[model samples]
Target: MHVPHHPAFPKAPRLPAASLPLALAIPLLLTACGQKPGEAGHGMMMPPTEVSIVTVTPKEVPIEFEYVGQIAGSREVEVRSRVSGLIEKRLFTEGNRIKAGQALYQIDPAPFAAQLAAAEADEAMAKARLAQAERDLTRLKPLIEAKATSQKEADDATSAVDIAKAALKAAEARRTAAKLDMDHAVVTAPMDGVIGKTLKEQGSLVSAQGDSLLATMAQTNPAHVQFGVAEAEQGRVQQELASGELKLADKGFNVKVLLSNGSVYRETGHLDFSDYKADPATGTYAARASLANPDGKLAPGQFVRVLLMGASRPAALVVPQRSVLEGPTGKYVYVVGKGKDGNPAAEPRPVVVGDWVRLDGEVKNGWVIKQGLKAGDQVIVDGVARIFMPGTPVKPVAAGAQSAPPAPAAKS
Candidate 1:
């Protein structure tokens, strides 16, 4: 067959099947060679990442121990009836402040009054009988002296007078007891405090024997906060104090409370009591702090967060909490160090932490470094997320400093 070819057209060359893969890879290799040095996916070398750092230095850092506490009244008393009677009137309102000796409830006084009247009548009859006996004894004594009556008769009269006197004394004692019962018909508060809801209402029967609890009262002016210190934590604290690593305030711990809403309480307290023995179930020692709560802001049974201050760690290294990272092994932090080429690099350092503290000028709390970090170590505080691997080059910047823009991309 006869075919004509155009002058402007050109034929393509064919490649062997074995060489096809090599021909495809050659272009990719050439493209890879054209990439800039130190670029990602081309070489191990990478540009330095900018990060904010904090230079750790040993200093006296204040230590605060926090615990969950419950508010309580300094004195709690139960208002009870001293006499058995029906509650006629409730003198005080429920959930109100009351003064010492204030009338809480009025029992039915009619029964007590009747008993008192009967005792008085008995006493009157005994007094009349004693008068009559004494008159007879006087007459018998004169007759015995004049020999008109026998001496034995006079002796009998004397014995009768003595019996009447004894009866009169017994009646007076009964009268006094009846009067006391009458006075006790009015139930009074034992101390100045805030009263709770009355357990016994009007027309409720109360007795002095057992069922006499009318209401409860609590003294809230000086509120007490009760908390527990774990046995392990207590032991560690003692060891630190003994080793001179921690020092306590001369006057003891100053306590402050945080409300549930994250607000600080106005009044501060002092540690007043600590139990000698630990609780078996919780493995903690009970402790208490006293504070003035004149406004009654702290109510009984309310929960609060207690901060124990006035203790400090001397010559301790600290780092921001956010800077610390958790790994498969344990907690660690990134520090600025010299790389193989003498440039700054991020180095992972394992750390053992102690108590937590809130330092000045820091928004978040910090951890006290017990080991693995020392003075003059520059820890990466901010831009921690930028670090992808250990020993990667990093540009350390002072915390809170603004970094200059990248020279407008070098005007490329």
Candidate 2:
């Protein structure tokens, strides 16, 4: 049959199947021969990883504990009025340091003054009556003795004198009470302290029965720093105390105050009070330290840190904090050990760590090694993440050195 010449069919002629296989094999042979000597078919061998190591050192580390605390006044009292009256004027500036008996507020004294005046008038009347009764008695007594007056008259005069004396005494007592009330109208500070804002302003009615709080005052010098100690720590401290490992003054342990900004207070403090019982809610015991704050730098209710000092460990194994690693079994550190062919390898050593020693403002310097480490052992401080196995080969270098790069290829 006559068929139309299609463009796709008239394109080209195919080669022999045997020759096709030979052509593909030629390219494969060239690729295989082009490979460099001693090279792997897939990937190249990686050089040993470089790591930093630190030799373990035993030190006499000072044992200290830090706890959050708050500053408070050594003595704090609420200023209140003793009598019911209207506040006439503010007598002291807010937040000003004051001495004991310093006037803080003035209540209206007009009513109290009038009451005192009435009491004085009554006392004067009583005195006049007493004088008259005494004169009558004197005259009646002589008259009765001389038979000029009856015995009943002399007895009545004596009774009148006694009544007059009682009246005078009562009037004088009232007068004293009135004077006290007048003096109380002027509110004064109970102790030397810094006064807070006045709660009741001028023209406000105040009373003694309700204990109207006029203001608050606090003695902040020698400030009281209040803190809480965990129950576990408290027990440990007691145990150490009994063992004579820690020595404390008669008052208590000496402490250092660290402000929130990481500055140490100029003055040292002494622990004065500790609760006998632990708080059930927080499992802590309330404690207080008295710190000298003559400049009033520490104020009431200021948050701070308290560092318990004056204790230490004679021999403590420590390592750079960076060497510590957390694993399934707990904390561990990579220690350099001899491997096959005398090559160095990383071996994991389990460790128990205590509190950290800070360098500058909370920066970690090293860790207190409680267990699983000894002096002179080398610990991997850097490049720990690259270690996949316990016996992985590593090139040890001094801590803080930069890892050298891979060597260049050898010249042909």
Candidate 3:
């Protein structure tokens, strides 16, 4: 009896041996399998994680391509001297508005006037010589016909008359040259616009392109705005130009200047020209627009932002950027799918992206799957990182989605 009892019972005491291991293992197993109140063994256990999210929405934002640019007016011209002379007097006010052909500077005309007087005196002397020669020839011709004068005498008189005529022609040419030189003494405005600072004042000798720029005039009546566009976008712009949809080409985009104080200008501009070739350095084609600047609101060398309308793509699929993941392959996003039980499940969707519109990316070829999502579907916009893992459970909350009771449907 002792031997039999000892064989089974001698291994360990009932509670002591088993209790130690049980106490140690029980807690660990419980902790490893522990979950929510009723989620044990249900695979609902989770680890803490962080997430980012974005929502899909449509907004009427301008299709804007932004670039840093300098403020430039339509008119810019450099005034230069047409002839070399001294700046005897500054007739126009510095930085004042001047019209074309308006007298701006006066050069001393004394030298030119003296040249003209000398030409006139030469002309009178030549005329007097011609008169004397004509009388000699007339008398010689009659005497020669009567044999009172020799043939040689009449021929000599004829030659003298020809010389006097030649002298008269030379004097007339000098007079015309002198008049042209006199006109150069007065510098006039080549274009009607505002004149810049006086580079040379009274008594300053300003030779052709010397250290002097008397003044500069820029025609501001209709000003210009120069800009560029990418070659890829040129086709769309050209199409808009041909169609009545845009009235003007890509440059024909309705341009409105926003001043420093955020005030809108009253005038509008039109596309004036487009370059035939693209710039090799930038690969953008040049374009220019003309705007009426009657009030001189637009100034040269100022910085401004341009808003342009591009080709519109209707029926475009879009998704918030936060939903997209940059995997080893490319950009992708998760879509919420419903299981047979209608419980939400997540599935990774690959998408081809296009121009970003605010926080959204234009999705193409992604519309093939119709059931999971739609254009206006409310996707996660915040806390996406917390739920971004494949098949990860999420406590979804919209950016502005507030907790509300589910609405009850009316009885049909």
Candidate 4:
């Protein structure tokens, strides 16, 4: 047959069949070497990947404010003596609860007793003198009327009676003063509370103005907490109050105290009062809360944190703190939104945050998303650091997607 101008049927003699196989293999190997790592030997391209992602959910979020404060007794007083004397005995045991008007200490009764006794004696003598004066006056009045003696003599007798009456009045005044001095010998508690350390022991001399204090008494039932709020944040607090963001009942706000070890106090307190003017030194306002201390867990000068949670926001959504990530500039999260194809797509959205609102945080500013995120979207909380990337495709695996299932226990 006649051959056309093709290389396969060239006029030159054909190579061996082995050489032909080799020539074909060389082009095939070259093609494999020239291809990208991901592309197959046939020049097929790899498709975009699909990654697993989480979405942010939106719900009513009730906002609250937390502050650091101090625990104090609602009614705290230092027990001291009204008059100067030696402390004879301390009646109430230290660190024990006492009642109002309870006698706490007894001064030396000897001095006070002697003074009262002397006053009584003086009072008795004054009465005797007054009796004699009355009798003399009675006699003088009749003498003056009858002129039995000279009018001048009767007048002198009346004057003498008046002088005796004046002497009795003077003696009676001394007795009253002595009795008052005696009553001050026994010191009593002004109010009901728990007694604290005793500064003066038996035989210790205490004066009315003595630097030495007898002891301290603190009301344990309703304790007080002193807290400070920054001056700049006044506007936010005012708005919350005026707008009823914080709903105080007929009483006031319900307060919770947090200790340094993160334990909640047993009792709830109420917001008692606020300072009229800002503190000149701190540039913050002082606030006081009355806390119940039935167990006496809190005391004055103890530092703690305060939470105001009187209102109820049942519609609010609470999320675990681990779901959110923080940055130096602000806070942000990766939310999975549905693409046109109904596939989940992750997008980075920034948010403004307010005071931490319990389990979930406050979104002071709203978050914007163009993808499939919705109110009830699911978020990947566990595998966050591994696969969170914006506009990137990934072969995503849920936190424990491939873990082997636990084998069933051996049949009994």
Task: Name the best candidate (by TM-score).
Answer: 1
Off by over 4 Å in 2: 1-59, 141-151, 239-251, 327-329, 340-346, 358-364, 375-412
The lowest-lDDT stretch of 10 consecutive residues in candidate 2 is 3-12
Candidate 4 residues lying further than 4 Å off, grouped into runs, are: 1-59, 149-166, 209-212, 239-252, 311-320, 327-329, 338-343, 359-388, 393-412
* lDDT value for model 2: 0.84
Q: Give the 10-residue window scoring lowest on summed lDDT in candidate 1.
A: 3-12
Show the colliding residue pairs in model 1: none
Mind giving the per-residue lDDT tens digits that candidate 2 earns over 69-93?
Answer: 9999999999999999999999888
TM-score, every prediction: 0.78, 0.74, 0.60, 0.70
Question: Candidate 3, residue 118: CA error in Å?
Answer: 2.1
Sorting all predicted structures by lDDT, with the top scorer first, yields: 1, 2, 4, 3
Error of 1 at 74 (Å): 1.5
lDDT of 3 by residue, 257-375 (tens): 55666555578765567799999999888877677888877766655655444434333445555555565555556655454446554545555665455433532212212133456
Model 4: per-residue Cα lDDT over 148-185, one tens digit each: 77877777777777887787788888887777768778
Give the TM-score comparing model 3 with the true structure, all chains together: 0.60
TM-score of 1: 0.78
Better of 1 and 2 by TM-score: 1
